[model samples]
Target: MTLLDRLNQDMKQAMKNKDKETLSVIRMVKASIQNESIKLGKDTLSEDEDLTILSREVKQRKDSLQEFKNAGREDLVEKTENELDILAQYLPKQLSDEELTSIIQETIKEVNATSMKDMGKVMGSVMPKVKGQADGTKIKQIVEQKLR
Candidate 1:
């Protein structure tokens, strides 16, 4: 089954189980996927495209969660945390720091990026390799640490 199919099945399950929070997040995800499809003038998105969208949704929720926590908005934090948890189910397994470090090292060598000026080249090469498996912010930090 495709990711969309799985999401549809889970959405139905959430509805049947009366899980309002899960249902809300799933519906939001579906809506975003549909919006992207509409933008591209297509009804179907590739697996990679779906993964990219899912990652974007999770990142957004994580950002909101952090903001809510910092502002002492416990109510919003809890709700965002729940949404993050629901979204996490669909994201690819995250990379370990060690694994990410190694990949960055290899990418630097492959791209021959020896200075900060080469940072963009390194990032461009690394992102495609780590897209779904790693967070871009974390990868940037690691690459910065390595390049310096």
Candidate 2:
């Protein structure tokens, strides 16, 4: 099913089950998707566009979660964690560390990146391959470690 359709179905279920958290998250995501479409003057978004929006939402939550943790805001941290969980359901399965490492290694070789100076080249080459499947921060860490 399309992401929007899935979201709509889940929204209905959440309402039936009185799941405020899920319902809220779904509504927010739907709004984000709709806003993106309107911004781009499109009536519908492609699958890649949907993934991009979902990825952006997940990244925003991750950043918030980290900030909340650093600030020792346990309540916000917990809420962000729950929101991340909800967002994750719409994203593709994340790459395991081993898989991500292997992909980075291959990309590094492909780009003939020999040092940290080529970090951007390696990242540019690898990001699209992993896209929504892996966190950019994690990818950067692995790329740095591999290059070093």
Candidate 3:
């Protein structure tokens, strides 16, 4: 099933099971996707567009989790963590470090990146291939290490 379809199916299951937390997270994601489609004047999103929205939601959840931790709000942190878990279920599986490293190496070669100055070229070429699979921060760290 498509990601959107999976979200809808899961939302229905959550409702049937009376899993309020999961339901809420799925609803938030669906709303965000719809809003983005409207903004882009599209009837539906492509896979890349959907991945972008999902990543944005994940980022928001992570940011909120950190803020709650900083404020020493145990209750809020727990809730945010639960939401993050639910949202994360929809994301692509993360790339293993070895897999990520190989892709980085290949990208560097593909871009003919010999130094840090070509960081942008390597990153631009790599990101599209790994989007929704590798974390951006991890990719950058690997690229920097390789360039150094």
Candidate 4:
């Protein structure tokens, strides 16, 4: 089933189960997807587009979690952490550190990126291959460490 279909199913289930937290996250995601579709003037989003939206949602939550922690807002931090967990359910399986490092090494070799100057080249090549599977910041850190 498509992402929208799965979201719809889960939304209904959440409503039936009276899961307010899950329901709220699902509604937010659905609205984001709908907004993207409307912005693009399409009736449906492609798999890549859906993944992009999911990744964006996950990234936003992660950033919020970090900020909340930094501000010592324990309550908001907990809520953001829960939101991240819920959003992760829709994303692809994440790449482990080993897997991500291996991919970065391969891309570095492919692009002949030997220095930080080639960071852009390495990142551009690696991001597409690992999209939605790895966090961009993690990938960048690995690339930087490997290049150094």
Q: All candidates' lDDT scores?
A: 0.92, 0.94, 0.92, 0.95
1 versus 2: better lDDT goes to: 2
In terms of lDDT, which candidate is stronger, 1 or 4?
Answer: 4
Q: How do the predictions measure up, each by TM-score?
A: 0.96, 0.97, 0.93, 0.99
The TM-score of predicted model 2 comes to: 0.97
Question: Candidate 2, residues 1-148: lDDT per residue as tens digits?
Answer: 8999999999999999999999999999999999999999999999899999999999999999999999999999999999999988888989999999999999998999999999999999999999899999999999999999
Give the range of the ten consecutive residues with the poorest summed lDDT in model 3.
128-137
Stretches of candidate 3 exceeding 4 Å from the true structure:
none
Of the candidates numbered 3 and 4, which has the greater TM-score value? 4
Ranking by TM-score: 4, 2, 1, 3
Q: Specify the highest-lDDT model's number.
A: 4
Which whole-number lDDT from 0 to 100 does residue 61 have in model 3?
Answer: 81
The C-alpha RMSD in Å for every predicted model, in order, reads 0.9, 0.9, 1.3, 0.6
Quote the positional error of residue 49 for candidate 4 in Å: 0.4
Stretches off by above 4 angstroms in model 2 are none
User: What is candidate 1's lDDT per residue for 37-122, written digit by digit as tens?
Assistant: 99999989999999999999988988888899899999999999888888888888989999999999999999999999999999
Candidate 1 segments exceeding 4 Å error: none
Residue 125 lDDT, candidate 2, scale 0-100? 96
- Inter-residue clash pairs, candidate 2: none
What lDDT tens digits, residue by residue, belong to model 3 across residues 33-130? Answer: 99999999999999889999999898888888899999999999999998988887899998999999999999999889999999999999999999
